[model samples]
Target chain A: MQIQIERIEHIVHENESVKTFFIRGVNDPRPGNYLMVWIPGSGQIPLSISSFKNDLCGFTVKRVGDTTAAMHNLRVGDLIGITGPLGTSFSIRGERILLVSGGIGIAPLLYLAIEARQMGKKVYAICGFERAEDIIFEDVLNGLLDELVITLGERTPLDVIHKLYEKRRFDHIYSCGPEPMMKRVFDFARSSQLGAEFSVERIIKCGMGICGACALPNGMRVCKEGPVFDLEDMEGVWG
Target chain B: MVDLSADIGIPLKNPLILTSGILGSSAHLLKRVASSGAGALITKSITEDPRVGHENPTVIEVSEGLILNAMGLPNPGVDIFLNELETLEAVNLPIIPSVAGYSEDEFGRVASRLEDAGFRIIELNISCPHSTALSSKKVIAQDIDKTRRVVNAVRSVTSLKLIVKLSPNVTDIVEFADVAIKAGADALSLINTIEALEVDPYVEAPVLGNVFGGQSGPSIRCIAQRKLTDIALAMWKGEIERVPLIGVGGVRTPKDVFRFLLLGADAVGIGSSILYEDLAIFEDVIEGLEQIMTDKGYDMLDEFRGKVISQILDMTI
Candidate 1:
């Protein structure tokens, strides 16, 4: 099933290497759903939907591979096949939520932060980048977040969580970043007896949940069961 | 439209079926693929006990079109799988249970239970590439005597149709195919994934946790076709009841399916392509195959079955 991109509304240069493309007329994907984007002749890749405004969706792409470089060349009115809103979403039950992201991992967490704010929940976001110039969505986060802490790579999101957990008393902590960073956060949260969930990044194919290519260590299908898994789901295995 | 239905001891709605390990995680997912247009579906290889399998990095795309995986045959065992099968009865498509075991007794026990559960077909999996990843013992498909004894043991326990899947890792696959057929296999799957290793140069380590895995995709298409051709040629010479060959390994397009059919494959399985295009690829394949048949003036599969082999034999004669 191929859904054609009706239009490209916005293409913002988030940083030196990242670009956010606003694809028009896609189904409104929840916080954790991903789109299997296909560029004719260039091949297909999985992209996390960054922003959602009714039918308009955003994909914050990092120019890291051949496919992403090819995706950067597309202009307005270009046709790109998208199949999706696939994968499990973040649970939105916590009263006070702590959101953390690093690098391109901010794509999904940014959308989640906005959705959580709109629902009248208190959202705290800890965003980290390698340097000052690498920081993205600065203005967006300032407006939606109850508290925004930006780190310039010196301190990780875990460090921020460690300092803030005693003061803020958050109901749930959610994170998506490099594996090492998330693993540290999971460890801290687990030791402190705090509920935490993190989104995993894997090689996803057939986003329709058929291909077991995205299977986790526990044999859970990331395309179907989760890209977002509760901390308990990753217990013992992470250690 | 071309009549793609096949009767390999049992009926299939089309020649394009979902290969084992592609999407056999849960019955709900299998039903989804069946409804999407797959002719039939096979479960992931199941063993007698639950398997935790290899760690993360079990699957990786090594190149543009190839994937290497060492999933280690992760399954919930037959006991739990039987429970899932109860939920799958609502699906209208034919379901074939794939069995993998460490010994002849394990194969017999699993096959016997599945037989009692009324499964129409049982695919004996002797070809998992990573079966030896945790241990030093050779996979059953790699040994002729082991293959024969395992197949015979399962055959004794079940009267249902038996399809023994073969490995492409062997020196002479046709020899093992002959032994399996003699041991009472009703059909055969041409090839499982080829044994391969991918080393990450940046880190100087094996990419898969199991150190080695199976290479699947367009890279193995011709190899599988050649193996199927060789075995079909041998079977023709031996006049061995013409057991249907289920061709697998890198079938992405209807043209690929036609190539397997020309090589004497009664049915074809789509594996790695599922990673590229998803289950809807089945519908595209069936439709593309129909269009190709219409253009080539093929109304039935029999008209084109082994047509390439016949042409080659005619030229030689």
Candidate 2:
């Protein structure tokens, strides 16, 4: 099952260590079909495709582990094995779309923004970072987002959550990030009376579903059941 | 001829069990494993009260292994657990409940509740790597007298079998095993997770939710064999074979189980390896064992528990 590796390039957007690897593949890898980069010796970890536009499949990755560390070591000409276009992707369609992200979690939703923009729908992205040092891909999303509110530092995620509550309503909301950060997004979506919101949870192993590893709120293995689930379905349900 | 009824003193249908942690958090997961073909199930370790546990990202994946944990042993209260067991009792599998505490009173109370509920085995966990040290709760198995007192206190209350789970994180595991035996523990279980650390080279950050986690999985096998042999040799020298010792960690297949038994483990507990396969893996391993036994005409498990040496001797080149 060898697929041609399409090159989706990046420009160093900021001083922070983030790069948007614009990728291309046939059957366009959806907004959440994270590619599994097979590092020769380090094995593989799933990296979400941030955006897939035209013929491009983009991965906005941060150096996180050995496999990721290997990704950071790559040059423009280096080729890596990507085993997916995996998991069920984010399928959202509505008049208004709200996208919230924490840190590197903002990567995948970058594509979703481009997607919503193409559909000529209203889109907003409320992205946050641990500190200013970890921000990336802001320049590309600036023009595409209707409400691209970038919050710097850890505390600002909360501040943004509270601000969104005071104003604005979207037909659909999407979030990805640390569990703590996502927990807040779930609450904000519920409080604002936002009807339908979804979350992209951090999942590991058994992306194919057999390992029983990545469990959701009800011991439902996230990989088999969902990496994307309706916020209303998981509300206050024990994870 | 094949039969599902066999007595290993404990009367298990198969040797495989849901060893510690998997769904040990609640009685519900325990019931699931029991139905999944585990001969028995060991519930996650519990304390006296409800705890909130560690913050998120509490679990992490490292190469061939995983590290988890709620720095918060946050369990539902003991009363809640026993109440659940009231339902668990109907699940039709032996529940080897795990009890942990920083103090004797805590362990004693939890054990008493299970004992009263007619639980047969209570595994007292004393080697949690992430738990806070207690003033009065003695790592008694390390100190003979404290082991004696805690064991005696729990022993005095009930007729249930006692098994003290020893931590591999210690220097001399056999020393602790001796304490458990001297304190009248019925049997022993060895080598809890090894305390280890994994790092992310880029961020230079630790991989686990807890900066350090007890390493489990195939990576710990060589240590497990060494630790098992060390404790076995010590117990053998003391002429104390009556206290059955169960070897845990690194048993990936029937071959590994054979090796552990040869190294002097009376029973074997397959841990993380089971995560890679289905729950019916118990029946698979047991069937493999039966085939091995049939080929050698060793009809009963007792005839082959540690017969690797005997088979080698009987073979002539």
lDDT of 2 by residue, B272-307 (tens): 665555466676777777677677676665665645
lDDT of 1 by residue, B70-168 (tens): 778888899999997687647777888899999999999999889888887989999898975544356899999999999999988889899999999
Worst 10 residues of 2 chain B by lDDT: B132-141
Off by over 4 Å in 1: A1-221, A224-239, B134-137, B239-241
Task: Candidate 2: list runs displaced more than 4 Å.
Answer: A1-219, A223-225, A228-239, B1-9, B65-72, B86-89, B133-145, B234-238, B278-280, B308-317
The digit string of per-residue lDDT tens for model 1 on A28-94 reads 6889878777665465677888889866899899998877898888886666666677777888768
The docking quality of candidate 1, as DockQ, is: 0.10
Question: Candidate 1 DockQ category?
Answer: incorrect
lDDT (Cα) of model 2? 0.65
- Considering only N, C-alpha and C atoms within 3 Å, which residue pairs clash in candidate 2? A8-A22, A23-A57, A51-A111, B24-B44, B51-B74, B53-B72, B54-B72
Q: Clash totals for all models, in order? A: 0, 7
